[model samples]
Target chain A: MDNSVKLYLPTDAAHIQTLKPNTVVQIYGTLYTARDQAHKRIAQALKNGESLPFDLHTAAIYYCGPTPAPRGKAIGSCGPTTSGRMDAYTPLLIEHGLRVMIGKGVRNAQTVESIRSHGAVYLTAIGGAAALYQSRVTACELIAYPDLGCEAVCKLTVENFPAVVSVV
Target chain B: MKIVDSNKIRSDVAKLITECLITPDRAVTNALRRIDTDSELEAAAAALIVENNDIAERERAYCCQDTGQAVFFVKLGDGVQCVGLRDALDDAVRQAYAAARKSVADPLTRLNTRDNTPAVIETELVSGDTLEITYLAKGAGSENMSKLYMLTPADGVDGIVRSVVDAVERGGRNACPPLVVGVGIGGVTETACTLSKRALLRPVGVLNERADVAQLEKLLLAKINALGIGVAALGGRVTALAVNIEVAPTHIGMLPVAVNLQCHSLRHGTVKY
Candidate 1:
């Protein structure tokens, strides 16, 4: 069953709509990494009408806080954190045009509603497949909230990043 | 009295954490292999785990990003004395996090201490002269979904089963399935929680020595799989790989039941001295 759908970064609404829950999705291109602290900061910035470091429209954020990259590696072992932790901030982000999230776990009711209404997708990365996930990332760099260390927002370039469409 | 060098313990713990992060216990891998992969999701998920293990082992990389909070359960021997055992554990965790990921942080600040130090060390005195240390890289996903219930003696066996099944149902795929369900029964409130976590260290599919507890484990396992949550809740017959219940004597009036979960990739090991 290698009929996995391929999704390139900067994907449009039409591509996301084609994704149903449980569909295997392999992603290519840029995906941002953010977890609890970074999400909190992003939410606060949005609430204050402060321009975010990255635009929310067409943005796909992975709920992750990865370890530091070792020598000769693009990034450290990176996998999805529990998506539910970001549930409170998610509806707001979705309202602002955040189209996709990658993480483990189910979302809260409000977050699920937001995901449904916004035509966004919540994808499931195999929770403990850190080494495998890391191999998919070709490049990584810290972009915001460096002080948060691993919790800092990062920009990652990946290819064939496998995930299952979890919530829609 | 047997005097041990603290440095040896520090280095040993460091190695133990490093090994556990990449290579899960043999029972965990075996359980993962045995998952009936009838659903494509379960099969695919299982493949990812196997590939992840391959990558981790071949490249010396972490199998999961959330290397988890370093929790060490120590069984100290009466005849053996070590002055810096605690410090050695703390130092070992710091060394391990340096190579992998630093998951420990202040709860209030939610900021990384940079060095993942100050491991949670639980110690009990045992009869032997060898110090035994059990390590569990407790991930946040499953941990966040843990439940603790305070039921009266009236709740009985039914209550205990409900508490476990309910927690697994509530957690669903978020707690990460196919899961190893750890049910802690009959302890003071907090002890139940600890016992539940301790239950996870047991080898997969192994029954408790107590026959009744073993039966409860089997019953709970059947009920859990019947939930049809499956792997990643993708829908199938195997939601839980096993159910392990750890029990202790508690107050006559109150019955405390706590359910803790470990994701399919249960990272744990034991080092004895």
Candidate 2:
């Protein structure tokens, strides 16, 4: 019982409510990563029309702030952070061409409307499966906001990255 | 004289706390392993979260660098009377947090905030002259989702399962998984919740001795995992790593069940004196 939906960017808000509870989907291609602090930066960037570190078109943004990497590991416990915190920034990101949004928990009404309007979907990752999520990440490079500690922007490469397109 | 220099014991307790935070417990370890073999919905949810560990560690490093919330559950023997126990324990927490900040490389944790603060100190009087302490450092994600339902005797077992499943489904990905579903059945509503939290102290996969209660655990596990709320609610087969049921006989008319959700980063330790 799996269905596919389009990806939402960091600020996209549509299709959040339509997401039936428990729908599974596989995530493909590149996406931006951000959590509470990073979202604020992304939102501020939007307000000023400043170029983001990564292109927003067709990008899927996952809300997460992972643990530090061990000696040789790419990342640690890189699971989805809460989605509710990102609701405020979603609509704006969707407007900018973010297709798929990856996170956990329910989205607010505005976010759901934006997802439906923008043709973007929301996906959830296990909240605390850090070691497991460590496996899917192929590579990671710091993109911006190194000062924010774990909350910094980092570009991650994922392969066979399995995610359920939670929205219809 | 003094009851075994409770200060020294507190220091030792602090050391244990430090160790527990840096390591993973059996419950959390099992939860991670279960995600691997979970069903499709469960797997996907777990897989992504397993991926999120990197971020969690980073957050752990940056936030609450002090790791200051060092509270303990102490059981003092009837033969002993430790003066300044509370003040000493508080000093240990403060000292440990200070040491953690100076020596520990990780970031400061969020302490003294809503749902995160006032480190819980539960003390019980027991036999002997020694003191036993249990250290629990609960994180926010899972703790936020914990709930207690006051059920009537009529609600029975079915009611317990429904309430728990509903909590899990509604909790979604916020609680973090595969969660240790601690079902505290019986006692008053608040005590039921405490029982549930205490149940979490049991090792992963351990079942209650009572046949009927054990059966209820199995049924509830099946229903919850079936909710397809799999890992991080990302969807998976193993929604909860293990359901631990701890029950005490309740009032004739009341059947209270408290569901305490412990996140995948279950950091807790116990010490017996």
Candidate 3:
């Protein structure tokens, strides 16, 4: 097994740049969960010059819509959604100081370029490995967009959440 | 005639939803075991995927968060009597999803139905007294990558080969690699798409019966894997585990081709009564 890097959230741009593709990382810290609907709302807010629900600078956003927890669990089978679907809204977030993005699948060319230019990195949690991944999410709380249900923005405290650096 | 209860169908459907989500089909597991990893990245991905399956099985949790749209293909015999079959199945889906706390998002409204009801059920009347129900929990990621094309006969099998390869290449990592490519050839537009999805119900690594069709499947599989999309589209040699093709007679002038990509999770099952 390759040695894994332990990364704390709100990572610095220099720290992100030091990481390379295929570097196995165990992430520890707060990750904001957002998917299609939440992204749209955030992008729309930015368009309207309104403040976002959460801080964007140096923050990591996980693209996921978790299942409802079943008794005693913090979250249920919370895995990454396809990152491509959020491609349209990603570049703008990166421009606004988002430093890390986590999801599965390849991002579009523009998003990749934004990550490169804006000093952000893209990581992929193993797609379909929700059950295993959920074990790492120590706590979860709904933060915004309660009406969106599963697609709502939530804050997750992760402990050694496994992922691979896909883009840097 | 064997009399099966509608309640049985409902319960079985519910069981299938849970079972398929938690444990992968045997063929898919076998294929995953056989994946050839060219890099540590691929190896790590394969390990995580395998471990995820085990965790899902041990914990009675879903292998994927999506848990997917409840899609069922039911084949019923003329002699079998289940008066409220449709309602029973719907009820079963609702109860099962509720028990699991799974999400079944409404397509138009994008709201969680919370119970995963109103399954996309496709039924056919068959000759025997047995009822067979095949369940597929199709995640949106790969489903969004599906495509249908209306081609001139001039395009031929080569055209299909090109289209399938191009779709996989274009899809890249989005649909999830180590995919199962289902190709539907020769039917009309919607029928071709349905046939493509139905073709995915076949076990992984199984080929079409016709010699020519099987050859086409083999060709398409090779080309897709050759694209180097890798596991989870991360960049590896094992892009696709299998390619299954289904063909139907079509009008002489028009040929429609549909492609449905199933991610490595490949949550599918069939129950017969």
Highest TM-score model number = 1
TM-score of candidate 3 to 2 decimals: 0.96
Error of 1 at B119 (Å): 0.2
Q: lDDT at B100 for candidate 2?
A: 38
Using Cα atoms, each model's DockQ against the true complex is 0.76, 0.23, 0.74
In candidate 1 chain A, what residue range of length 10 has the lowest lDDT sum?
A1-10
Best by lDDT: 1
* DockQ-based ranking: 1, 3, 2
Instruction: Give lDDT tens digits, candidate 1, residues B1-273.
Output: 888788999999899999998886666666667667678788888767777878888988888888888999999999999999999999999998887677777889776778887798889898868899999998888888899999999999999888889999998678767788888888698899899999998888789999999999999999999888877666777788889999999999999999998886688888888
Better of 1 and 2 by TM-score: 1
Candidate 1 chain B least-lDDT 10 residues = B25-34
Worst 10-residue lDDT window for candidate 3 chain B reads B98-107
Displacement of residue B63 (Cα, Å) in model 1 is: 0.4
Error of 3 at B206 (Å): 2.0
**RMSD, one per candidate, in order:** 1.3, 6.9, 1.6
Model 2, B50-151: lDDT tens per residue? 434433444442221213244467777888766767776666555545423222122355212322223568877777777777887665567668888888
- Candidate 2 chain B, run of 10 with poorest lDDT: B59-68
Q: What is the lDDT of residue B105 in candidate 3?
A: 66
